[model samples]
Target: MTPRTPLAAAHAAPLDLGGRTALVTGAAGGIGRACALRLAAAGAKVRAVDRDREGLEALAGQTDGVEPYVLDLTDLDAAEAAAAGADVLVNNAGIQLVRPIEEFPPDVFHTVLTVMLEAPFRLIRGALPHMYEQGWGRIVNVSSVHGLRASAYKSAYVAAKHGLEGLSKTAALEGAPHGVTSNCVNPAYVRTPLVEKQIADQAATHGIPEERVVSEVLLRDSALKRLIEPAEVAEAVAYLCTAQASFMTGTSLSLDGGWTAH
Candidate 1:
């Protein structure tokens, strides 16, 4: 992953999320964790939701304003229930598996759609009443370049993300009348445990060494050579929650390193 851009070091107006209750899924690590911390830094009381007990505990230890909520998103009802009364929602939990469509397991495909697509629907369902009632809310879906484009051997992930893109746009339309803004930040590959673990699998699937996977496979379509940092993704999420972005919804912010520019 590339180091934090020097441009970000320049001082700018600070985002203040004071008094807001932000809920971040998959908050145990990576982009989710960075978002939780960033929101906390901005004075929001962040509810860090994740299935990883140890990771959540660690996150709580590192931050003063975070409350860790441990729950599996697969339990859609529980997932929905957990989003109750949240002022800001970051839907960031996801799982990926790469294989030829013919060889992909049926059960895994269902799980992917369930976790990535259906769960977001339920979470939004649960969150909407509160958001609508308050006449203010933010929904940031952590989509990907895959959501807008296709790559072989990632049918389930691509399909789930594509469905999520549709869901996000629909929510934006419905949310418009209710003072809620829904949008997606579509980032390219990021440096996360999930992506790190996939390196070997990608190498194996593409018939390349692990060392070559980063340069040749991952960056093949990217104009920028380095993987995005989780904090960079978090910064984009933070910007959406600010008043400056109140008018921006039902759209996508691409952090794809020009992948979709083609």
Candidate 2:
């Protein structure tokens, strides 16, 4: 017996991303901000990308090893270029427009698809070469409950998330042979600016008061009637980067409070 391998030593070691480079898009705030900080804490140098220069500057002020890269993901070429040479790629940038399909502006729909779906494809494409050469990488796509289910007046968001899920799975299959893993983290109604902005829109769309939006609309299907914090979602993203999750790819880790349980 090898002294039982020392349970604490074998199983309780902290996640260490020492010397790794992590590229996180939409890192100016919310989930992306949380992820940047979390990975930095784990000893990875984080390349934080976003269009929000002020926000990125603010984020960089709070941490060491976080380099702010101001680039809007809608610029497909730039988005791809920014992902080069990253050991970890977190595609977490997205925008939403809550409007019925019939009322949706075609230009906005195109923009939504371009930013949310096409940008991730380009980023993953850019990341794979470096990852494959090194034979290890982690890709985490921050998706939403909308990726699996749908709600009225959220056509563009639903479409983008659905597309993201498909893209993530495809990457998982292709990258498996190269020691890279791709996965999605689907969270519902996070307590972030995105969700905060949606309250008024959802209220108008559902013909309800804004006060009722949280309880009656957002949490209606959730078994746990609460909004998830950005840090909570970031923890899941961090887990996927660890060795324990090496075999878990091409699937979604839903932090939906059982929204999909039904």
Candidate 3:
């Protein structure tokens, strides 16, 4: 075989996150939980925040360096408070409500937006001063493929994700000179509890079988013909936190399995 590329050789070495403190929102389940676990395994002290107290505690119990915090992201003050003392912030909390725009409840719309967009912005704003003082920081916003494109029946989620992309870009610009970077990981459908629920709901609504929903409703939109894994997204987040990624900011790394290729 040909010799490995220089970049590939560098990537083969393990990332060192020792002594770093990271705050991961929505760390109770799915992608968030995976990210928290991966960070802890890489030697980071992680503050795992989520609305599910038991779930957060369970995750903390399993991970050596994880500290669980039960908090709602819709409350900006609480989110900001949870973010204090973190060198890295992973804004991964979000909700998805599937309904037509006309049928979508106003309260649900506001709640999703508040959690996905507003809370990430507030957390970044609150965390930046401390990061600036340290002259180093990383903000990883877990956006979605929906952020880059649109789909039917996901009005609120898509809108909130789109707005989050913009906010991350703005934050990246402001943090550039201070050795801080802000970037987003936009992934397509991942096989998570959230997606499982979506599959069930879609099955019920569309009068299709649960098995068919994954292939027909979810992956049908993607060119890769596969759903992404939570670990895949978590790996991308971890890569962005490294020293090599210092020059990267205000950009999105899409893990969409070619969903947006169309």
Looking at model 2, residue 113 earns an lDDT score of: 93
lDDT of 1 by residue, 13-115 (tens): 6788899899999999999999999999999999899999999999999989999999999999999999999999999999989899999999999999998
Pairs that collide, model 2: none
User: Which runs of model 2 end up more than 4 angstroms from their true locations?
Assistant: 1-12
lDDT of 2 by residue, 39-80 (tens): 999999999999999999999999999999999888899999
Q: Model 3: clashing residue pairs?
A: none
Cα lDDT of all candidates, in order?
0.93, 0.94, 0.90
What TM-score quantifies how close candidate 2 is to the native fold? 0.95
What ranges in model 3 sit over 4 Å off?
Answer: 1-13
lDDT, residue 54, model 1: 97
Give all TM-scores, in the order shown: 0.94, 0.95, 0.93
What order do candidates take by TM-score, descending?
A: 2, 1, 3
Q: Which of the numbered candidates is closest to the native, going by highest lDDT?
A: 2
lDDT, residue 244, candidate 2: 72
- Distance from true position, residue 54, model 3, in Å? 1.1
Q: Which should have the higher lDDT, number 1 or number 3? A: 1
